[model samples]
Target chain A: MRKIFVCLLVFAVVLSSVALAASSIEVWQIHSPIPEIMNAFDWAAQEFEAETGIKVNMVRIPTEDLHTKLVVSISAGQYPDLLIWNIRPGLEFQGLGVVEEVSSVIDEVGRDNFPTATLTMFQAPLGKQWEIPLFARLAGYHYWKDWLLDAGLDPNPTVLDDGSMVVNAYNTWDDVLETSKKLTKDLSGDGTIDQYGAGFQYNRKGFGDSAAYAFSVITTFGGHLFDSQTGEVVINSPQTVAAYQFMKDIYKSGVMPPGVVAWDGYDNNKYFMDRTVGFIVNSNSVISNVRENDPELADKIGVTIAPAHPETGLRTYSGSPDTMTIFKTDNTDSAKEFAKFLLKANTQVEMFKIMGVGYYGPLLLNVMADPFFSEIGEQERMFVENNKYFVGPEYPGVPSPELITVALAVYNGFVYDDALTRISVDDWSPEDAVKEIEKRVLEMLEER
Target chain B: MENHGGPRLTMMQKETRLGALLLMPAIIVMLIVIAYPFIYSIIISFLRWHAVYPDHPWVGFTNYIKVITDSRFPITLRNTAIYALVGTAGKMIIGMILALILNKQFWGRGVVRGLFILPWIIPMVSAATTWRWMFAEDGVVNFLLQRLNIISQPIIFLGDKQWALAAVLVVGIWKGYPLFMTMILAGLQNIPGELYEAAEVDGANGLQKFFYITIPSLRYVLITAIILSVIWTFNAFNVVWLMTKGGPSNSTHILNTLAYEYGFVGMRYDYAAALAVMTLAILAVFLYFFAKLQKVEE
Candidate 1:
């Protein structure tokens, strides 16, 4: 009896030892303070752990504070096992060698699975193996199609039609101005305007949403900041001169609100949902939010293609890719394996569809092209299929994104100068704006 | 030998042991808290490191050189100087005047004293945010100014390059003056009434008493306050960063903001460490000169 008991105990000890031998994946994700997504992240980690017998940990920080926190912590030798950070910072992190390379995992994960929406980031700058893309974030207008018919610019053509609205696809700066002129009207027939055509922002800077969106309109007019490959800038080009000129013209034409320059999405969204503005240009996630926050507007709202390039039929919107980096390490084995798991087309589909409203588009081309993307409903398929190209602002003479950050800053700084604010719709020249942008950017670029 | 000194003291003289014993806990705490972080920061500054990264690289003085040559370097240094000089001087002047006023017995004296410290009591980031709201184009301050017919148009205080630094400096003075007032009040309370009594007995006037007695007596406190204020203001990034982010075209960026940007925003730890190292070097020189000056006062 004693011998049998001892054998059973010994067997139990061996079993426990084997269980302890398997490792846990200690991952740290930079968290935004959204409750729904936080819950989703927790659930996903649990499921991943249950499936693999690996422990998954997530450390989150506030979105506003993550940039500085990651920098200081990483600098101080306190980097987490794994973290999700903005892609721009990923570049700097790469330079510091704090991230592990996971090229094999990317190769194995089947790059073909990631959506076309996020391919640019997965490629990484200069084609270096550092991080896999975790999410793709983009923004645009969630408009009121019914209102467009009422405003008299719908595809069905809201001509001589009262109590209905439609808006034109913003083509030339002149076309947008003319549409806005018609859109900004006093329905009550009072002296004051009851509605406005467009909205803009002079405040709320972070990740450059306000400025970048506004600048995209400038870009749609054929304005550019830098050369893509040369790492040189032509910021002071003629294209940019026209962009600002259009802004001034719109203001003078009394289409957008006089206070539009000081208003961020907070004010703009309010004006939009209040049915006081013809359109609002902001994040894609805003479509879901409008429905949730103001269902009335949701019923009235419809998504549309971003403004097209004046000459080319090319449509453009800012693409910000969120990456999942295997931080730099000498041990390529586990890191590569982990990255491969994340890169799978199945995983990309899971990332988009499983998460809340699919704010993150898949990095795999197949997933982006797939109908089952997390947040994209059948209603938004046209936008997804036809208009999901990723493009960052170009630096004029230098073809580098790094230089573009500087040029954008300079242009935004002088955008509202009262002295030279002579903007006109037809004069929305990308060449002129680029020339003005170059003078300021070259000094910043040449600084060090 | 005298009988009192007959027994040779053990453990490095009896009186010195008492003093060492009294200070032992304090010294130990300082070693654990101050000395350790200083050493850790020094070691970290040498290595190219990130906490989340699987590996941290080692880069030497390259970070230091990079910070100096950065375009924002001189601008940051210059901005820091402006904030320190103007902010500290403004606090000193306001504090000195307020301390003199409060020195006299008055109605609601205690209430007035506490009220003056309201700015200091509020959390810095919260205070800065409130200031941002106040300085906003359509905020209460502009409304009030417009009502008073002070200006025809609202000024974009935080959005303009030329005005951002001046506005940040003003906010610093408002947030920091209460602390200065408290210190000056303490200094004022310490001055003996007998000195004023004696001065009055000798037919010395109010200005004479102030220049001869009050000025000399508080000189040490004034120097200490100035030194401390300069250091505090120079290292300050919370208020200015929260308020303007050295923006309106990098107009308000100071040394600490640069350190944060390079380290965190730029994600260049080596560069950040270099900026921090330069900050330390500058502070060390200031401390050395200050110590020398303080020794003369003693």
Candidate 2:
């Protein structure tokens, strides 16, 4: 009996030492609707573990619930070691002082590898980098090519030298309105309109597709929610009112679906996919989804930059970059190592190839030269070219911590969406809606 | 009764000690889980607390003041009152009617009762999602209405601001009536048949019997059900949130959803806490009357 007890003790000691030698890091990633993208993360984790002997535990939270879950987890002192999120929440997390600065990781990964615009956007207010930039999503208008052709319009437009598309028939807001009128048809001759010409999400749910589209329109119309230079509340400007008026005109003109006012972020994508609408402004996720699920529909889709304001001659597109941040935790070193691994050019290219071209734009300039990008389809090429005009959430204003805070305030409060809702649904004058929005934005900024 | 001891403990004292020992764990759990958070939320309500910021300075009643004076406050308050009152009334009426019908000697009564209880049995998220889809422009609801020749154009039930709240109320009433139905059904069963027979002997009609005998016997159950229904309806966030998200022009925002917007989206924890405390206070006043009603019944 004594001999058996001693042998068991030795075995226990060996097992304890082995357990102590092992290291694992937990990653809380926003859940991707696409299975390939999700599986890519798992594949990367397995590869990392094989190379480094450090296990990666990935927890997927739905995109809508990520922020709330993170906040609650942070308060409970149970946050993950690394958090992967889109661009907007990173600054808010940094401001909350829950993220660790990762400048060293970026340096180790080679700073020159990433695009200057993508790199600098994450480095805000304080010159410290809080997140490692991964992939970017550039927003543009996606249209049904066949529908455009059926309306006697040019199905294939010319791409300018500056990366802007020139579809003369729908190149400007007024042109879009007229083209939409032509595209809104009763296909079955049942007196009930079957296809809406335009699709825009006007719901005030949160910072979603609606807010992004509204911001693009506001910026294109030469309006800034805040003064670009001084960061003062300027939402009540004539330009802002004009943007709201245009949205209201589109809604009232019977071009957009009547239910557009209540749509969530993904509704427009569904409408576009189902061919219920002729055109929609969205990220490439819609096309990616189509390519995966409905390849026939994917072939007929066309992509271009959003319409330019005829008078201002300005067109703005929004860019949301996927980023990873290390939380202030005991496993910061392991998390940083994993983040650096994701930044490696080969790893990024592999993930991008798996997700497809237009779904995610390259963060690293070197990845742009890869054969995958060269052999991409026409729509994918246009999506990549449109990145030249892609701007951050603080479009008119510079990307600073102060301005990002105000932008987040406007976004989180759904100011633009509310203003649009007032004009379109409640029948408030654009000026009145803008003024109410200005008041709300000012209050939010004051709270900040 | 041992002579060696200076004094002997009483049996009552020993039982009391045992009872206290048994109750200690539950008391500690309540203190930790319920009391702590409740008090913490009340404390935060008096401070300027943004979740993203580090410093939380005390601002006294300023947060409460802002909540009251904010432009959206009145709108949210009115929406909440409408949702709570109308929702409760609708549920109670529907529940009472269903219970009255099911109480009679009817055909396939068990199956009918089971079918009526489905809205309650179905998960709230699933029910809300189904209802939202049903209320969509091109959904079955519109198709049915259009096919029945009720209207030429399909009603954008969840999209139009004018109809959004009504649509939400319809779902709320549908999901909630079962609880009251079950409670009132149980109450009806418990009542002695002698009272109804006595009413019949006195030549009291059906409506008279219902009002004079049935209502009074089920008075306590009805009051309890109303209180519970009102509280549940007022605090309902899932149906409204999942269906409309307090939207189509912020036309459907109740206090709970607005507080969620302030707390989670806006990161204005102080404003959210104040809104929560105010909701608690309003419910407390309602519960006070309910307690009084219970006492009178007792």
Best by TM-score: 2
C-alpha lDDT of residue A411 in model 1: 42
Model 1, residue A192: what's the lDDT?
A: 59
For each candidate in the order shown, give its overall lDDT on alpha carbons.
0.63, 0.83
TM-score of chain A of 2: 0.91
Chain B alone, candidate 2, TM-score of: 0.94
Please write out the lDDT profile of model 2 over residues B208-287, one tens digit for every residue. 99999889989989988998888987788999988887887778899999899888878888999999999999989989
Q: Please list the residue runs of candidate 2 whose C-alpha ends up more than 4 Å from where it truly belongs after superposition.
A: A1-22, A163-169, A291-293, B1-7, B293-298
**C-alpha lDDT (0 to 100) for residue B155 of candidate 2:** 87
Error of 1 at A247 (Å): 5.9
Model 1 C-alpha lDDT per residue in residues A118-207, reported as the tens digit of each score: 444433454455666765554455556665677666633121133212235454446666767777887898455768887665343333
